[model samples]
Target: MSQPPENFAASIKDFESWPENLVHQTTCLGVLKAHKTRLDVTEPKLFTQEAEDINVSFLELIESGPTFDNLEVSDDEELQQRLGEASRRGEDPKCRFIFIGAGSPQAPLKISRKMLVRVLSYYQVIPGYVDRLLEFDGRGYARKDMYSGFLSQTLLNHTPTMEVDYLGRSGRQLQLCYNLRSIGRTKRNHLAPCHKQWSFRHGAFHHQFDILKGTAVWITTTADLDLKKRIEKSTGKTGMREDRQFQTPEQCLKSSLTVHLLLCDWAYENLRVYFLWLDGTVEDEMYLLVHNRRIHEEYPQIYSLGDLEALRNLQEQTKGALQVLKGNIGVFSGLRDFYHGLGENDGFSLRDSCIGDISSFTRQIDNIIDETKRYLAQGQLIAKIIDARETIIFQHFQSQATEKTEQLTTNMQRHSLTVRIIVFLISIYLPATFASTIFSIDVFKYQDQDPISTSNASDPIKQLVSIPAIALDRWLQVTLPMTCLTFAAAGLWLWREDRKLRREYQTTPICTN
Candidate 1:
């Protein structure tokens, strides 16, 4: 509905005028709406014959027990007292629904397992696919998809919903689809699915969703089991940390919806700000990529960018942030749909002037996702190029090392002849010295017989023209007793020295340095 500006405080100001049991509030934001409601002016009883068109099975449509064990209250006495006081007061609630905080006072409306059944009892006719919507049979984690998404039963009676693609502030509008579902006496009560729509762009004359103009019991946000925990955990209050303790249920619903709509507008504005920030960040990254050393379209950069690591991290964070935005889009989009869905469902005219803002937000969210994916792909390419260049450089160094090893092998081959010649000379000199010791022959005179020439393919060990290292017949006999006497003299000399040191008075310190 096109709701004009309202002084919400004034609407709820007649505190004493309101019914004493209008809302059953224990804490700040607890249960609201009486079990038995009646018309304020007519004073028609909802559960008794005093009520007009009362259903015989009225108990099935509303709560009627001494206590709400459905909610999580501990004390039996306290629970009974609360229920007893509410019943004795004789107040009636108009709305068929009850608002439960679910867990805490500040929490949003959350119907517990028992509360769910109570609400189900309220409706005489329900769709067959409600089980798919609730998923109450099983426990643990649940997935949000076809049945779990924000959109409820779009086609209530094979009728399409009222929706359109976003274009601008004043875009072409389409007809809305409306349907109503309620229960009364099968014989007397008769109601039709009211179908209504209007194009806000054209300013066509038509009625919209019912909220303020009397028929609406409660102007609810998205009421799905999926948001049960989320709403319960919502710590955000309506205003700047102010108290809303005195607000009636009606006031709370109206104020909360108004704030929720404003928040939708604010979210769209923030999206524009985020888009600008993203554009600047991307531009800076591109500038840095080109500034260090120009990147050509035709060729790839073989060398890695110095700040590539930092840039990749930034991109990763950006991608994560964008993912979070996408999730919010899904949630907030559902909320927006809930508001727009009102236009078609009720008799009151519901048309948001800034309905186009939600569509624009959706487009921007998609764009951010696409851009993030593209940047991640670019980062992968840069990483690949750097890896390829590293492989090339490594191969070049390996090739040079192999060439140096081959040169060392060639040098070893060239020195083989010189090494053999030195060994042969050592063999000749040893033989001459042995011959002189055994036969007492003058080596200076015998050495002139033949200069050893064993460099050719002749046996250097036993050649007739070359001298051997030792003569075959010559042998040295050991004088064993003389060698033993020499060892005994060395032992006696060491014993005499050790005795002299033991008698000395002074101890010398060893120098470490």
Candidate 2:
């Protein structure tokens, strides 16, 4: 057989809209549907037909009586009048309403603020026909385009009103605005920055939402029962007593059934009004399962960041913070008690946090200031030491440079004096050479050459040769020995002078001046 395309609209109409009456009783409200809802139907006959789809068995049980006892209001004449009118219109006053739901049990059930907020977001029912119901004409539910959180408007934009008997006060009506806005803001602030991460550090009930009942509600595990009870007491004193409580792990499981329930009952009342306005028959059409699944999957993740480990770690941090806060309270309490009992002067050491090591509250600030001054004094001392070391090193380098400069100057002066002495010796040798050349030029001319020399002179060539020989002999006699002696004396004198100068240098005092 061929199946028709899932015409979601047609398919949706086949099932009933959600059962609003069951909302208070179960974790879910069964789906329901009706064309002319009790609120929508002006005629009495149409209203009866519309409400027939609601659970017949449940309606029979209510009609049978005991359930009505819980709902009857003796003093609420207005509510009684509305009920009579509904009955006269042939509407089944037994429209299956909230009978049961996950409630606070004595067992341990530990729940995160995230989980509670998610649950609240899931049950956000839209009361579409409340304004038309006449007796409960709330202006917020009258708007045709009013959505729960779509189109940038929160439940706050559409203020909801509810009739309730608070404590001893009966028939009093209040808006869920203040509580809803507070919780919504808390959840929004807590989750707004979590898109960038996997875990968030926050206090317990950090993302709490009010259950239309006026207080914040938290469903917790059985293991934390004792702590939760104490927390409730604390909340009462802290002026947050409006927080309601609930239980998780509905069936019997033994991980420790201690649970904490935070009620946003005061604020959540507005949501209840919006939900109440909904025609019981159209429950299926305005079904919120998709919204429920989205909350279950996404809301927790807004704080958890997809990592189980991170989530646990954040939980642990929050728990630790809670413990620290508890300890602080205990300390403060002990201090108060001690002061009250002044006679017991056992001198309890008060450990102040500002000065970590100090145990006396009286001198805490003084100790901190003293420690700061000590640090500054030590820093200045170190700077002084560093400056002194640098000065010493600079003085040592100055002394070394002065000695090197003086040594180089002495070596240059010695080198210059040696060069001048060598030039002077060369000049003396130049004069001696000129004088020897002149003397050797034959002072007696040709007269000294006797017989053989005169005879050889007559023979022109022989005379020339004889004259040259005489000149050579004279030149050798005068110049050769004299040149040798001059050179020998120069060498001996230079050696002796160098030795004497070196000895004088060795004996002389080193010039400090």
Candidate 3:
């Protein structure tokens, strides 16, 4: 959590520890709350189109866990495939809204859903609003609203969605959302009838109220902005009240929705900061990959498997944040529409301060939304660049690896041929050497029987040496076993190697990529 200013910490913690019932009925900013009180306002306007759409989807939604294919999801993916095989049978999350609020309890009594409705409707916000908020009625409800559920609440019901939009004359409405686990510490605290759900209806409203909180930016619609500008001469002297008070209703919902938007604003800033951190990361990684350098000092991390995983995670987060911003447009648009509606009305009012002052605060939110989008775009661009660089590096290494493998294979084949040539040369020369040694042996030499004597001048004295002829059987005995043994040894080595390769191939898994 971004460290809140010192002024808010103690009070915020105090607000968090209150029981749901007390918190809902609490008064804050000096606004008093009456138990079981209902604001004298009409129920939220319901659109026929929404009714028709829900009528069509009513059957599917009631079937326990509707699938992504069946639900009105963000045109993205199939639930089964995206969730993986283990989660193929996953159940969709049931809506258990924890309508937490701020302020000190006026009454600490538990109320039934009927009574809860009466209390939450104190500000003219729709009763049983979460029913319409959670269901996917062929309209957007699963849309991200920054963990703050109310942003998408009145969306389906145009009347209330556009209802409670008194924003015309300093009209402020807010709804606060909390995790159920956070508010109710004990089973009894949660055991009220409000904890139960109605069949095909909303659960109990766990309204949480807030204390007087000041933000760097206060929210106001353009009407208030324009109204603040037109100065009406007041009996009081020159000071203008840009933050003027308009007595309109039993509640000011600004704090409720303010928390939601605040959470969203903080989340967007976090995302932007993350991207800024990553910008330098990719730059350093790509440099290291392509350049040879001696890093004599500490610096950002080099690329690794973790970096890839982080990149993937960042991409997913960026995409999610983008979807959230898109959905937020509805809430922001509601504010804009309210402002325009105010302009359409010719109201009689005058105030101090630049009309721009009120608007400046509200408009700050709109700018934050815009800034989120730009940062997401920049993150996306950087992600793409990293992907391209990764691809280039992979291909470069792969090509080199392939060349080395081919070269080694060629060298092996050449060595095998050279060995065979040496063996052939030995085979041809061995028999010749054996014959010469046998013939030169003195045991086989016989002295010339006839000594050199007076003989005819035409004939030279000759020495006759008897040569022993070896039998074909003896030669076959000596050579056949040797040749057979050499051939058998070569075949055995090859067979063993082939078997080993076969076993390895069977054991290894085939990679798809």
Candidate 4:
């Protein structure tokens, strides 16, 4: 057997007064005890009990030793000889199985340093084993090296000396630590439990077993209470079942192995269900995107900015979930490989049937992962299509805008030509009209009475459009003051309008491009 450190007692003493913050507080404890019966009976009967104090119970077990009595003589001569030899050699022939489960499933169990030291001391486990157990926390994904079990140096040496002749038999001691993801149902409405909402939780536990002494201790945290109940119930049923046999401690250990297998099966089934849900969701999203694309093609204006934004959000959310699912697949693969290693390891004798079940789970999960990859690719394609279609719609609107601008420019140019022609005509007739009005003011006579005497009388055009003559002084006096006054008034109005425009421009807020 492996020995504890030389200062084991001192170490335990040091932990006795250790602060509470540094250790785990005590919680609920459950015990399963299996006592060996007659040699002829193939399996030992199991009993369940509860412990009020962890330290006291452990102390009792250590002091009292194996609970089964091996002194009674058997009827079979060969078996009796073996028993007698074992007794003479100071060995306990009768096997006793004791399983102590500590802590509830809702939270992780905290073992005080003192309690840890005590348990390790009683089991004669090496000090290095403490470091392994210390790493156990019931959260996070399991790494490749997370879920593992191994045979210690002492167990490897003791296995060859065992009297049993079974193939691939387990050693006297074994240590396994594992983490599993468990699924549970959540009631969106308490009145409607069948509404099909589900959540995921994790369970992590450490198992330490001494086969010869029939003692097993399990330390767990953040485990699923319901799953633990199921395990406990199943273990009880196996002990009570008539067909099953537990003739040796190895057989009992095998039953425990079955529990682990059952757990794996349960976890795998839940994960499969979860993946199917994800597949359906992603498929539905893809269909919706395809439908939207068709609508955009037929009636592009129907889709608004808000609609596109919502679709983009949905796509991102789905992508994130898929990424999480991929990670889960990786973690599940690690779990599968951990169990596969157990099946091959000589220390645990996990049957071929169990390994086969693991393989089946692997193949199914792999298929789901492949399908998930295809969905990811399809999602990316849809995103690109949306971007391309949006660009096309924007370009179409831009072209329409350009066509309207060109039309406006042509109309403005035509209007400007009309205005220029009107200005030219006015410029030519304005001087002549002003001069006619001044001379027609009775300041000069047309000489119509002596038309024949006038020189222009002979020319019909000149006689019809005659230029009247007026006194030079009167004409200058009449036009000069009016012209100067008109010019001065126009200048004053222009100056006032310019100042008004400047003020308005200063008050207006200028928008920058």
Candidate 5:
């Protein structure tokens, strides 16, 4: 749990008679809730850049950090005590780094560093009222001005070299690890390398640096780099309207530009991964981003951008890269089935469903691309918003598909009783149908008129009139009662069987005492 802010009430406005202070306080509470609820970084330590003068080897960082090295008793104890103290104080630690690993040379050195700052980057977009408090309390100032400025400066200074070799392999691997870790927590720009234009359209910037294995860089950016630092923006110093002037397109562009430099470094690290995944030569030109842009631009024939156009070309030129990846995963899944030798089909249907899911996902990506292009052409704020909505919709669709799949599985497993009931009814109906057919013939009148002949029933007319007529009358009278009795029996049987099945399906032992 996080404590509410002190100046919570001063920030919010327009509460139909609600006190400004109370609204502000509520906003602060919400912000705290959001911050507290964010996903924990699974890797304990957040990798950070070594000091400028100390050029530590990648292996050294990994050995020193929890990622590869065993934790030193001292560090573990110290961290435990610190956490305990913070809990007692009802406060979060300012920041701490703990060393944790030892890995083979092949794995190299990678440091795991965890800090709230990285978490806040995605989590700290406070509500309007909370934002006002952060503004009033100077927390907002620190975040936007000092934080973004420092980050921008660092990134600008170390614009990732276009050359992939400059970024060490250990760093490259860590970049991959971080991405794998972060993608679930945040919106991913996995498509960026394949489609550079995507970044520009969405105002998204991706970083691919590894702090532990290679060099870790902490970078931040503001929507307004210059204006956020202005002396006039202070609570007592300037009016709210005055502050709005600073939040302009130019400011956002400047901030984006600053982050862009850092992104370039990240991209440099990222390119190396694809290069290694592929041979020096890549089949998907989009992957050539691992090569310095200049180099590829110079040698256009050898490399290609893995954008929509490139994807189309690859589809035309050879095997579908997406299909190949899909097929490989499917085959791997089937292999697991083979090993288990489970029930019918060995997840063949599951594989097909998985392929369908992948296809839908790929199509969504294409749709986003198209939507983005349309927005760019229109060049309006509304258009941009529409594009963002489309992105959100794509994400929502994925969520819905997962939910639907779970629901389908639940329904299939739980409906056996219904199926059994249906089967039972059909079986009963088969006998009832035969009885009805026999009762439908004529012959009742002949039997009624001749007593002796009726009793003997040697003649066809007499048999038809007398025997069938009697049988038909009896059947009509008995059929309803028998049907009702059969249905009641079936229902009772099914209920018991359903209970037994349900009990077997459940895992917990029933309590007898």
Candidate 6:
């Protein structure tokens, strides 16, 4: 085996400096061998051994090389002769399979980066592909729509470039990245709804296949036990007896594609279940809302803010589920196209049953997309209903507030009228009372200086009365200054109170809601 170029080796060294969190640690490796009509799948080995042990095993496999090199013989007779000799000698063709799994749903593995780089290099994968594989951050990548369509530039750009021979006889690689959604189990018991308690885990399925070399690798940021079991049980075993020849690289490729199809099926089933759960949850909430509306008609205080918020949250989740379904549609379509393209390019017709199965799978996925869209529409409609109910609730409260304010204003007006009548009565009686008390005092006196007799009664203006003007001037001088002082104090108090109100209004924050 040839050594990696100096620059490539240097690049691999850079990975040694990567943080521990960036490395993938848990990896499983498997080897498959084909002997004439029989296929054998070795038990997969996890990477728990020492580094030296791993390096020895890895180097041995690399030196042994692929088993289907004899397929390069163009002449049919020569190819048959070689295959016969190998079969007689019990030298079976073999392929290497690797699975890179995460430590948990939220964390990627910490596998040695150098070993990963070596494996990719042995398969003749370019540096760009290695860079992408190592640099992928699940947290960041999960936020974006990675797959739009098979022919989309986004897919093309992310897919690694592969090298092919002049005659296109070798070096064909296919890479597919897809999303998988699964429900996680929890031991905690709570009063929350089951949907709220249920945890959903999202993972990306990464697959790289070297069609001619029989080397394949699967990577995921989240561990999937179902996928692992399926791959192990179905590896190297084609269900079709007529297609059991497994000696040619094309047959191996078909088997590999079958495994991918199984993965797609698994993904589709999970999505269907998840969608149904969401639909049912939304439907339940809608029913509750309708029932609540009836109750609200009788007792308006029975409104629940939490129910409306929960409904909105469910709608958002449904929207996200719809996006996932759409992305899966693109994946299914792309795989269908890939199968056909491979058959056309290789000049060998793939199994009719296999093609039919893939076509049917694609159609089923289309049905899923349609159903998801309808569910999303229903979610939106429910959301609008919630909004309308909220509007009605708000108006009801507002009218109650208006009625209370009107009653309060009428009470205040009645109280003001009673106060004004009391003040008017006081004003009318106060001056009369003050004048009677003052005249009764000895400050003013009337005297008759001459008495009129019966004979003098005919004479007018005989009697005279004496009164003092100084008493009236003294009372006016004292009352005028006292009234002016009282008015000044009242005015000052009112001005200060108005200023305090202005200051408070300026300091307080106005609520936008």
Winning model by TM-score: 6
Off by over 4 Å in 4: 1-11, 14-155, 158-172, 183-185, 189-198, 238-247, 293-513
**Per-residue CA lDDT of candidate 1, range 23-42, in tens?**
21222322122211122221
Q: Could you give candidate 4's per-residue lDDT for residues 108-183 as a string of tens digits? A: 2333333433433333333333323322333323222333222233242354332222212234555555545445
The 0-to-1 C-alpha lDDT of every candidate, in the order given, reads: 0.31, 0.30, 0.34, 0.42, 0.30, 0.44
CA deviation > 4 Å runs, candidate 5: 1-192, 195-458, 468-478, 489-513
Backbone clash count, each prediction separately = 8, 74, 13, 4, 32, 7
Worst 10 residues of 2 by lDDT: 251-260
Top-down lDDT ranking: 6, 4, 3, 1, 5, 2
Residue-wise lDDT of candidate 5 within 465-488, one digit each (tens)?
445466566776767777777778
* Structural similarity to truth (TM-score) of each candidate: 0.28, 0.19, 0.40, 0.41, 0.20, 0.54
Better of 2 and 4 by TM-score: 4
lDDT of 2 at 426: 66
**Rank by TM-score, descending?**
6, 4, 3, 1, 5, 2
The CA-based lDDT of model 5 is what? 0.30
Which ten residues in a row are the worst by lDDT in model 3?
54-63
Comparing 1 with 6 on TM-score, the higher-scoring candidate is: 6
Which lDDT tens digits does candidate 3 get at residues 1-513?
123223223322343122222222324522222121212111121111222121110001111332211222111122223222212323211111112211111111121223223223322332333333222122211223323233212111122222211111112223322211011112244532212111111111222221111111111111011111221121012323322221211111232233334333433444544555556655665565545243675543334455445445444443444454444444444444443333243331211222333254357657765775676578568758767765655554565556776998799679867866776655655655555555566654433233332233235432122222343344455555655665566667657866886897689774322
Better of 2 and 5 by lDDT: 5
Model 2 Cα displacement at 109 (Å)? 45
Poorest 10 consecutive residues of model 5 by lDDT? 176-185
Better of 2 and 4 by lDDT: 4
Worst 10 residues of 4 by lDDT: 31-40
Candidate 3 global lDDT: 0.34
